[model samples]
Target: MNKLRLLVDSVWRLTWESREAAHCEELFVPFNPWRESDLCMPSLAGYLENAEPGSSFKLNLSPGKYLPQYQTDKKYEFALESFASGTRPPHVGRFYPKYLLMGYFGNPTPFRCIDRQGGKFTADFNHPLAGRFLTLEVMVREIKQKRDEKGGECLDWLDILTSGPGIEARYQGLPTDFFEDDPFHREDEGDDRAFFAQPRLVSHVDTQAQAIMAALYSRLLKPGLAVLDLMSSWQSHLPHGLELGSLVGLGMNAAELQHNPQLTSHLIHDLNTDPDLPFADGQFDAVICNLSVEYLVRPFEVFAEAARVLRPGGLFIHTFSHRWFPPKVVKIWTELHEFERIGLVLEYFLRSGAFGNLKTFSSRGWPRPRADRYYPRMRFADPVYAVWGEKLA
Candidate 1:
């Protein structure tokens, strides 16, 4: 037999499963309930007391709906009750996939459901397989004599690419305080437009990073397709030979944008102030943000807007280097190690929930013959990192 537990608020739902049948019931425990908790649950101590090291079992559950008392004004209160009750409504039909509720902030919980009218309602919080009568399988791997270390060690760039925690996991690992710092808060928290009004016609990255970026654009971007060069300046750094149907630039400095030879049209907008892109839905084939991602106060929101403007299957690419305006960069960027910056970008893409088929590329190890002569003592060339994702078709 295998034992498992399902916790909702302060209550515990325990199950005992055998080859023949599985039995489950609720065991209310007296304790203060938390508003939100980590998704990973605690292990069952009762089952492990006598279990062998190699013992294992499997658990399977099906999808169903739960109906609970609901009032728009009392959403949180009812949501908590629904979670504790685990009540289900009777509906005779084929089993379907679990219904995802639209309302309620934070991560998705089973306590609430959204109706067609966009009204929030409390729902039964039964496990998806409650009505299907599916068998529960459990497996006991190893019962460690000593507790394992909690929290994972930060990974290097190469290790992150090869063996990933992936985008979603990395996003979840970030602390709430990680994004709350005011490193970019200026004494003159006045208009950002005034700060960027003067055009600085200098490239942020070295020649090697620029070349790598142009090369990447040449390979990934095709000719005669609409493109949005985000946070652009006097030069898009697109490949010299590449042609595009339309190239639109969005930047802060009007003078810089007017000087850009490749851009057919341009708009002066500060992303830090207004993260929303001034474009229709699916307006571009591709969107590229070059060497400027670190400056955004709300990168996840900006990435989401990028996804909204891209056509189905359109690409959004963000390339950055070690170079940045320290005063404008987010606090998290300044605190994290160089390699961990890549993970942070990955999290931005994943947190947006607006793109698919995410990937990362690096030009960290590339040779820089020109840079070597200019800065001989420099241990490495301008390290370029890019993370991209495609809009879901």
Candidate 2:
């Protein structure tokens, strides 16, 4: 008899107040329906209860159905008496630790700096998704049975979902500081030649994150299509055994791209120095950049160039995580909330004016692989964030 059954559900959300464009987000999570009661949210418990191995469906969730505790409060939207301690100077559209306040100053709750005047900062302590609507799309990836549940903490999917996902949408569609103070500036402005002189041959994200990335790529990619692994490394993160027409890797370190076994061919190039791609227009079916979008100093130019190189309807994708060489990441990347980073990437797609069907995807809460080095330091795998759009025909 079946016991614990595995399932994955995705969430879609969009909100626009003053901004003409809608902020879109898609998030996914895998869970055991039988073991975690709270995770099997009441809205879809019956649907999951009857789900079979390949079941799939979508649900339109009300604003506060899953999580109503996030009631809006006028007090949560005012200016603080003084700039809090143990944090950097406040900036509008940025999130800071809530515990820095006099009351819960010890808590790490997220407090967004919605407005900043000449000498004071207006903070909003409301949950990022406090009043926004959401749509939950579920796909049952697997439904294998296991031993009986021995009993454990009932996980709350909504809490995990809301903890840090909805911040991607801007406040009242107001633009964050994406272009202010030199967004592309980095701490390490040294030569790329010296920074990548050696082949590190390491995975930026952990094994679980790698697995999720491979799975995501597997679904988006198909056989017999030329693909470019831009900003490539030794690990392309493509699914093993997946066949493609041709796979070319373009990166700075020759040694690292050379070691990539899946690449049919590889080239050495530094996109930061030259945003223009060497490939001809409409040469490849797809282009993918992983774990390194934060390093693009000339992202706007590079994204437009990517659009030029793709065939009509070709897709461009970028994936990233929280971890990176701190010195090399763009200045704005470190400033926004984790989810807000998606908004920045989405902006790149929008500004290019060369792509459409824009969307962002993310998945979190998977158990961190115990064998991995960061196992003890983090309880879950590095959350995966992705943004992709197809070249306008």
Candidate 3:
């Protein structure tokens, strides 16, 4: 019997939202294509039979293979106790446990909440991937012989990737209500300058996650583009040896920006204090904000300013993970589903009206580097989420 290890990249869609990419890597996959028809889907076995270490291939899973295409029904709608902020009620386009809505054992599957009225909240029981076409890019991490031909569980990588409340879902079937209280409000109403006064030279995400973010930047950032690293800290996660025309860091802490090795020049400017960028229009080819977008109180103003600074065809990219300081992040950000957070950022681009070709990405289930401090506690690396679009000119 053969055993395989794979990282599955699933490109899924939601109406009007950009395509969502989810990457899941598995340590062990039993490979008896004929006997394990249930391993992935029937269509996946053919690819596994020939897969090998370091090989990657893409395939399309027919619609309805996930759950069924979304169906219109009454069971989805339910009433809410109240819309109070303290109660933490469910809102539209987020997910909740199946049991939470129905009052019984949910078996751990998450259901998308599609709507919330004055008193009721509707839950979409359909798999978030339902009706959405699934395009998978599989990379065979390792393939080896199972020393013994013994029975084992058929761990579906797709389920592991998309399962539980971990996955983010559709932006909204209808207009989503933010909340009764202000979402832009943060736990600490103190001036941001005061909060960021001290230079915290620590990595927000783990080292492996940092490498992934830099890899992402390397792909989107052309070699000679003038890139702006907005709200940057001590370290700009640009690839080690990239040649750029100029790298500018704009942030609150002067010392932090000054310490970033990637920045050609750095400025201590708080977008919260002054939403406008201090640059001529069309000056930069691209702008990037990393791990710090959630803290922006004036995101719309900042986005408009970013667009104004970018050249006609320039790109604006924002990458973030699930970590944030509770007292500093915008209140709504804390409430967003990890994927819905992508939609939240995507909205920033759409509202700009200056960008197109928008897309979102999420990578999960990668092995955490053993060297990282959290490696002992967390199984996989911290999931990385990014949203980006290019200016229309």
Candidate 4:
């Protein structure tokens, strides 16, 4: 069954486990001792033993007022007494999805129900689902194999250790800077590691700027081309219905890449430190870097790397917007005016000596009112521009 159902079912069974099991009575004093004589106790301890802890844990025995006494170290005893009371009051327990059940396989560590409110409730010191009984709503079974007297290495593990060869090596001439320079860079060697280690999964552009990006992508990208998504994140946001042979994502965060449904294969690498891509020469038909050029301190090396990996006649297109984290964006990007910034990017592509035809596109800012209707005092700015080039043979 799904993990959510497993968690919820565990909590449901706890109400019965605490009441019927003889063990729970051993822990706490029951409020209504007289009722125990009329009930049948069942073996629910085994069920509780396997129950996964829920996201929120609370005991509402007999659905009355909240009992603050259960908040103490003697909570197990209180829970047992409440269970025996069998009042079955409106109850609430920590059983929800989107929770991490933290525990070890062989330990007596406390199981905690952590909620969004930032409160961690430690339960009966047993598994949170320990005081419950379970009914199997569904059963899962797999085919079993009959075994012979002698057991040899399993075929799966053996095959993993003896997989066949993949692509053969062919030497493509490396760029001059490939062997001469180091591309891997760290902003500050002595400062907090978080400065560069953390991945900020956010859009680099505003909504209007994103529309501009999508428009540029739509115009430049076509069907049946192998595309490289450079500096990708949790979202690629490529224009819809564009059929491409391949879409390879290259980024820094593995978790981000793993969940990106659009990527065929993702490589986790920090380009600032090493511009050398883990790809072959002329491997992609097109390369797209969206809203990331401002962050590149070593733009020349990265641009060259992009050109090296792109096939002849392939396109290297990058779009930029007005927004950027000031500190993180290189000084050059932060200080430049619009025309200068475009020229700067254009120079990077031209200087790389790997691109053939270079071009630029600029989308003026949000539509302005007619000059005669304008208010006396205001200046607005265009927020986006894109520069691109074709890889040379």
Candidate 5:
């Protein structure tokens, strides 16, 4: 199986094993829309910031474990446990479902004090972050890379540590185009549904392009860091058998993404429409944008957002191919030829002014033989190109 799917399966098992036996009680995990909600969920620790005023989801929980219980219905209940906040007195007298909506519900279960102790009680079936706006800072802790117990090799785990803010390195005043003609920046002109109409699970680039992607992942991706596959498709083309904390995919089509077992979880979004990412800043150790840079019109704005969200010294990698549909490709790209596309992506990063220590690399392969007799959409040669930049503090 792919790395992302493997991680999800392993994590799901671990979550199950960790919280299998406990007194079951109804719990609230608020779905916070604002605050540090851009980072990927299911990986972040703790209950997230509270949801908006009317948003709430239910989970049946057992004590000492985070995953909610979904099996049998057993009743051996005790009295209610009124929540007490640190540095604040017990508010049992004023405890209403509405108060929880307005107040900061810290890890109410872990290290929380109760008015009447020693008895297990089900608090009101209210959401934890009912009325309050929470400011949550995300941190990715240990990513386990499990290996075989024997002398044989096994999955390697990567424990990501937050070493303060990311490193800040300055660029050496490189002359770059603040605005370049993008070859693939056209707005969808046809019917609204037609724009996102087809779920093309096909890889835009040929085998050469895919091989380059695998090699790139192998060389740049460490064994245990959380990896974000931005502008992702059905296939991440990540190298096989690599250990990763999490391999999250962010793409537009649900069906295409669902088929990808590698994605532990995926967010369906169109960057062309919504430039702001739904992830917390510095949430991932690395972000991979593969074969999709050509389609971005607001490249700088997107890059800036990526830089803002990335940890200092976090890596942002982009790979592109000299292939695109004429109608879908931007005016600029249609105007330029193949080799210049690489120059264009570099200009994109430089123009963003958010990336430091930018570097470029080329994969060596025989260019596809150009077809003398051509059908309209059939191309003869495959193009390969890639570029990378590091986020500065």
Candidate 6:
């Protein structure tokens, strides 16, 4: 299996495995129409309502009531177009029957449609798993007591990293709430192609930050080795003295990539659209993502791809500063503070499970004046952060 699929399956299993089980039972439910208010009941809600406390039941909902059908003479094209354009159609809220049907069936069901005479169309919204026997093993873990609330001191990224798994374990799961839903989850979703069509020669960070990044690259990267500059633009910021056998630039803009003097070759591809990298396994000695980590919607997948493309023991260096297109940045990056941001990146590396010897480094620019200090010697500066790890077998 591919790495991405394997990772997803592993996560799915882990989620179920980690649950606490107290009681379990089997049940078979039939789908039947009731009063308008009763129709809103969830498939499992009816079974749970009558069950005893601290008990769980496995439900096998009947399928005859959730059969797929065709909707003819419907203007589905416009609706689909609006959805693709990151907007909900005006009539979507009014389509209660369709939603009700889908609730009994399933979401993201198989949809087959055909264009017909005139502006009308024929569409099928059938749940892919409909009519199939499903076994749901439910578990009930009762909470008898609540832990006392205590306001412990907030630990920064440095503290968490140094304290080991005790702290880091808290960030292991998927951070779904840390991002926007659907269309917004896709960073740079709309008009991004047009926004990056032309070459805009500009440096994203200050010269000090660039220097720190270049120095890190020089220290970690070797001479005459294949490297990948992911999400690259016109400038790669590689140290002038360092030379690489091959420097491949993968980004969204063709013109900007072509203008990059360091790139031996370049490919135009949006990582958000597809996290899979277009390269043979273990092709690169190192991979670098500079000043663009905030824009990734699926960072874990991209990190896994980086590991796949890197040779065993190869390096993956990701660097970023407090500079980004706000609209394109993910919610997590904008909502969280700098220290938490580092923790988030650390979570990305840990979740990928393809790296070892992880390390983090930060550089602070010009210090703030003494009067601005909230604490003694705690001065504010333009900070640049780098998190790197070695590819593991």
- Give lDDT tens digits, candidate 4, residues 281-302: 9999999887778777678899
- Model 2 misplaced regions, further than 4 Å: 1-58, 68-81, 85-89, 100-104, 117-121, 137-154
Candidate with best TM-score: 3
Per-candidate TM-scores read: 0.54, 0.81, 0.84, 0.47, 0.51, 0.52
Better model by lDDT: candidate 1 vs candidate 5: 1
- Ranking of all predicted structures according to lDDT, beginning with the best and ending with the worst: 2, 3, 1, 6, 5, 4
Q: Clash totals for all models, in order?
A: 14, 1, 0, 15, 21, 0
What does the lDDT come to for candidate 4? 0.49
Cα deviation of 12, candidate 6, in Å? 44
Model 6 local distance difference test score: 0.55
lDDT of 5 by residue, 136-255 (tens): 222222222333222322321111111100001111223322243333446554532356557887777766557667877798888888778888878887888777888889887777
What would the per-residue lDDT of candidate 6 be over residues 44-157, giving only the tens digit for each residue?
434433333346555443444332232333224423432323432322111112322223333422232333234333343433223323234333332122233233322222
The regions of model 4 sitting more than 4 angstroms off are: 1-193, 196-199, 367-382
What's the true lDDT of residue 388 in model 1? 80
* lDDT tens per residue, model 3, 1-393: 333333322222212222432323222233454345466665566667666567766666556765566566723666685222346678666665665544645455566666667888766677665655556565665555544445555555656555432244334333345544687898898988899999888889888789888888888887888988899888888899999999999888888887788899988888887998999999999999999999998888999999999998898988898889989999889876676677678767776778887766676666678988887798678888888888886
Q: Pick the candidate with the highest lDDT.
A: 2
- Is candidate 1 or 2 superior in lDDT? 2
lDDT scores in order:
0.56, 0.76, 0.70, 0.49, 0.50, 0.55
Ranking of predictions according to TM-score: 3, 2, 1, 6, 5, 4
Query: After superposition, which runs of candidate 5 have C-alpha atoms over 4 Å from their true positions?
Result: 1-187, 190-193, 364-381
Scanning candidate 4 in windows of ten residues, the lowest lDDT window is: 162-171
Candidate 2: tens digits of C-alpha lDDT, residues 207-250:
98898899889988999999999999998999999999999999
Q: Whose lDDT is higher: candidate 2's or candidate 3's?
A: 2
Q: In model 5, what lDDT does residue 216 have?
A: 74
